[model samples]
Target: MKTIVQTPDAPAPIGPYSQAVKSGSTLYVSGQIAIDPASGELINDSIENETRQVMKNLGAILSEAGMNFSHVVKCSIFVTDMNNFAKVNAVYGEFFTSNPPARETVEVSALPKFVNVEISCIAIS
Candidate 1:
């Protein structure tokens, strides 16, 4: 059966969606923005800071599902501008030491709250 995952450490979904969903040994996390859970506001203005917050948010969801960045098998990143790609990747790289998960980064017209970056992930236990 499918199981829903959530964590108070992560920002609550602004709409109708669970923080993550687990099926067997795999967990699928929803896209995470830079919104801080406690303050309910974006963490910072710079793409680097925002990307760090986004990674933190994803980490919370992964932790809640009994996983971590090492367990992540794939990631999908969305950015408002490709120019921020290197900065975002720098922050994202901090989480995975080696053999980082398969990933795709794409520039999009917009994102929730018009945030500069957003990321979602899938991990296996």
Candidate 2:
């Protein structure tokens, strides 16, 4: 069985989906953009800031699901511009100081809200 995981600390889903879902010991977090959960506004001021917001959003969902970054086993990062990969990775690195999860960063033509970055993760509790 799966349990829907959500938190007011994270952005609400824009479509018909939950922020994250937990099944057994694994939690699957949905892709998170730079939407500010408190204001419901996009935070695209800078690539670093944008990525930070995305990570925060992911963190909130994981926390709600009773997990943390250390529990994450995999992650996927999507960026509109490959040039911003370094910036995004720097902010992401701050979250996982050691034993970082396996991740793939992909550059795409565009992303939801046209934001430069989005991130999602899978965690094992």
Against the true structure, whose lDDT is highest?
1
Task: Tell me how candidate 2 scores on lDDT.
Answer: 0.93
lDDT of 2 by residue, 1-125 (tens): 99999899999899999999889999999999999999999999999999999999999898888788999999999999998878898999999999999999998998988889989899999
Model 2 spans with C-alpha error above 4 angstroms = none
RMSD of each: 0.7, 0.6
Give the local distance difference test score of model 1: 0.94
Q: Estimate, for each residue in 1-125, the C-alpha lDDT of model 1 and write its tens digit.
A: 99999999999999999999999999999999999999999986788889999999999999988888999999999999999888999999999889999999999999998899999999999
Q: Give the clashing pairs for model 2.
A: none
Cα-based TM-score, every candidate: 0.98, 0.98
